[model samples]
Target: MTDKQRTDRGTREYRMGELAERAGITVRTLRFYRERGLIPPPRREGRIAWYDDHHLARLRTIAALLERGHTLSGIADLASAFDSGRDVGEVLGLGEPSEETPVRLTPEALSDYFEGETTAENLSAALDLGYLATDGDELVHISRRLLDVSSALVKEGVPLSAVLAAGREVRGHAEALASLFVELLRPHAAEGDLQRLRPLAKSVVDAELSLALDRRLRGS
Candidate 1:
């Protein structure tokens, strides 16, 4: 890998030995993690398994969790939960996420995404906020829309910290909106109806927020 590529944390394919070296783990430990289902199975090409950046990210996350006082079993569970999207879907009960795929960012890539606002303190804060999770050497964001919006705000001269703070406030409001919709739907709506009608809540919020912004800009 070139210096730029090595530092950028974008896509790269690796053999078993290379993956272990990149992740700073021994081959045996890598194998053990695979056995424990911490990392997904690699693509098979004949007899050789090919690992990718995703696997590397996961390995780095496991290491970070270990440093954070998580046992292997706990990390395993966390990995499984995140990978399965169960935490995002069920535990959070947020219904379908916005029409955006998850984003996996390396620390460096995340800096690039947020325009160098990714300080160590901010990173730790993001981890604490559950907005980010470490995987081997990458950060996993569960929502592409959120990542894009935060980065856009940073580009517009908003501080990353401020954006995150706003996100925290927005989370409360979002939960309230969700609860309102659920309660409103519960009496006559079936589960499928609840799912189908969820978007109406977001649409109402979006339209109202647009009008609010328009009024504010017009000094009304």
Candidate 2:
């Protein structure tokens, strides 16, 4: 609490093992993260890696986010926000603001995770559609319902990237569709018409989505 107390407490630099223990992750996992480009290579003292509190902080943050189900790639975007000195408001789609913490992932690994015909593209598309995000080196589905939908699609041999790409491509069209409806309903509106029409808006959305599927089936 005083200047002398502050002076007495000095920074402690830890070796990889100690840092990993403090961060509640294995040393090997830390190394794996380094190899995956999720973490920076530690400082070396004659072939021995040394980590500081900063590294520990980053690891703790990663663990927390992962526990919260954020994928590594999504975490990376959130981390970038912090690196650029962005506030929590800029990073989290939230109600309150908090100080930024480090959250990151390797982009290459992310691309690789969804690369090939397996489902990388769809996974990437899921990320774009806000279905996925990085927690460290992991990808997370923000919506459990969406995750189930994606899983079903994957079972059908539909790549995640295609879905994500389609979502991205369709976003503009969706917005335009919404704009058209908003205008159409605007004419019959009252001062707090939005409140009265909230349930109707949901119904309209359901109808629109169903119509889209019906159109696709008919076309096929």
Candidate 3:
């Protein structure tokens, strides 16, 4: 067994031929994708090249995208956007969401969530909105609630692009609301009290939004 076959952490590694076979592609095609920058460069141990599960996952994602009628150039752009997007830690910053559950997803699974709407532009927009962050080769949606809501909206014939635009708008309002609440409580409440009372703020917003939606519907 060559050093290239295994890593220090015991991760499975494959040589080019083995990886190509596992990915159901020819070595030549794999090299072509590499040359085109569709995939990241493989780890090299002197003359031997090592590919790991991340590389395999990427290859499978590329194949799936191709099956979905995505052009090679488009796939390259998506790959670039995915690679450059912020990671989970950066998105969360100092504190994790106290109430919202985070959901981790593979790239293919995320495509399944949004169906044919997982374009490079949409991916970049989601990243910008802080809805998605990369964790290694996987993606972490900041909130399972948001993920479910977005997926349901898409199922209801809302375009992902439009949903993302609405989310961007909502984010601004949400931040402003948060600031307002913090300002209102800061003089009277300690930091710990503010943290503990967050659900009260959420409740106020939820009730108000429901009433606002009712008013809008009645007006319409």
- Top candidate (TM-score): 3
lDDT of 3 by residue, 5-68 (tens): 6678888899988889999999999999999988899887788788998898999999988887
Report residue 24 deviation for candidate 3 (angstroms): 1.7
TM-score of each: 0.57, 0.50, 0.92
What are the root-mean-square deviations of the candidates from the true structure over C-alphas? 10.8, 8.8, 1.8
Of 1 and 3, the candidate ahead on TM-score is: 3
Q: Which ranges in model 2 have alpha carbons more than 4 Å from their true place?
A: 1-14, 20-36, 41-129, 133-142, 208-212, 215-219
Off by over 4 Å in 1: 1-99
* Least accurate 10 contiguous residues by lDDT in model 3: 1-10
- Error (Å) of candidate 3 at residue 182 is 1.2
Candidate 2 lDDT tens digits, 96-189: 2132233233433333333333223344344545544554333343444444554566568776666566656766776887677677778888
lDDT of 1: 0.72
Looking at candidate 1, the ten consecutive residues that score lowest on lDDT are: 84-93
Candidate 3 off by > 4 Å: 1-4
Q: How close is candidate 1 to the true structure, as a TM-score?
A: 0.57
What C-alpha root-mean-square deviation, in Å, does candidate 3 show against the real structure?
1.8
lDDT of 1 at 22: 91
